[model samples]
Target: MIRVLAFDVFGTVVDWRSSIIGELEQFGKSQGLQRDWGAFADSWRGGYVPAMNQVRRGELPWTRLDDLHRRILDELLREAGIQADEDDVDHLNRAWHRLAPWPDAVAGLHRLKERFTITTLSNGNVSLLTEMAKRAGLPWDCVLSAEIFGHYKPDPEAYLGCADIMDVAPDELMLVAAHPSDLRAARDAGLRTAYVDRPLEWGQPGRYRVPFEADEFDSIATDLLDLADKL
Candidate 1:
């Protein structure tokens, strides 16, 4: 039986792309700048994995996701020749903390919470996830993150560590994620998998949807509500 449900936060539970784009647009307006904020948001998110890989490969010491995001933002700003004060930049960097949840996220989480212990299993740091949950009204029984385990998802240690910390066997913990790569890694680590589709996660129709084989995941749902039903 699945006693715990661990959610992947960024694209799955919260709509990061749209939220970031909105934040970038506000920042651009404040700076009297005109640029493709959509592309800027995409570029900022695009840097996430590579930044994490740097730590995974021992090129950098373990850094929180917030710091990684700032590093990427600094590089992007330099590349775009956009200059802003430290306070403004810091506020903008915190856009991730203020991301809005998907339409079904809060309600669906409440629904699922009735049946299982719900927590975050994300690469975001503890403070980041906590603030996000607070801002977005995400109903999490607890918050867990890469910072806690000193590893990121797709790493066996991260997956196994979640199960360990929850005091559950891998099979008893279900990893509900929108990313196939994350789900696959959890499955490989002996956890059950649930794929929640977020077709607009990249902010375009069918642009970045990952294809998966039938039966690849233990459960597949159109959204968190459907995931609750499936469970």
Candidate 2:
């Protein structure tokens, strides 16, 4: 029996792409510059995996997602010839903390929380996820992250560590994520998996969609509300 529901926050619970693009647009306006904020947003997000992989591969020591994001942002700014003060860049880097939840996320989570203990199981650091939950009113019973385990998602340690911390068996902890890869990893770690559809996660339908078998995940839902019903 699943006693805990661990959510992947970025594209699953919140619309990261749109939120970052909006922040980028505002930043551009403040700097009196014009560029493809959409593409810039994409590039910034695009750097996430590579940056994480650097730590995963031991190329870099365990780094917080916030710092990884800043590294990516600084590189992107240099590539685009954009210059700003440290304070300005720091504020902009916090755009991730201010991401808006999807329409169904808050409500769906509340419903889910009534049945199962809900917490974050994200690659974001504790501070990042905590601030995000506070700002977006995510209502997590607790915030958990890869930082605590020193292993990012797709790693067995992260999944198992979450279960351990929650004092539940791996199978009793379900991972709810929009990404099949993330769910697959959790499944491999002996956890139940739910795949939530977020087709517009990349700002366009099917832009970054991945194929999955029909019976691969334990449950599949159109959104968090549907997930509540199915669960």
Top lDDT prediction, candidate number: 2
Q: Write model 2 residue lDDT over 91-181, tens digit each, in one string.
A: 9999999999999999999999999999999999999999998888888998999999999998999999999999999999999999999
Please, what is the whole-model Cα lDDT of each candidate in the order they appear? 0.94, 0.96
Instruction: Give me the runs in candidate 1 sitting further than 4 Å from their true place.
Output: none
TM-score (C-alpha, index-matched) for candidate 1: 0.99
lDDT of 2 at 163: 99
Alpha-carbon RMSD, each predicted model: 0.6, 0.5
In model 1, where is the ten-residue run with the lowest total lDDT? 201-210
Q: Tens-digit lDDT track for model 1 on 144-188?
A: 998999988788999899999999999999999999999999999
How big is the positional error of residue 182 in model 1, measured in Å on the Cα after superposition? 0.3
Reference-based lDDT, residue 205, model 2: 93
Worst 10 residues of 2 by lDDT: 130-139
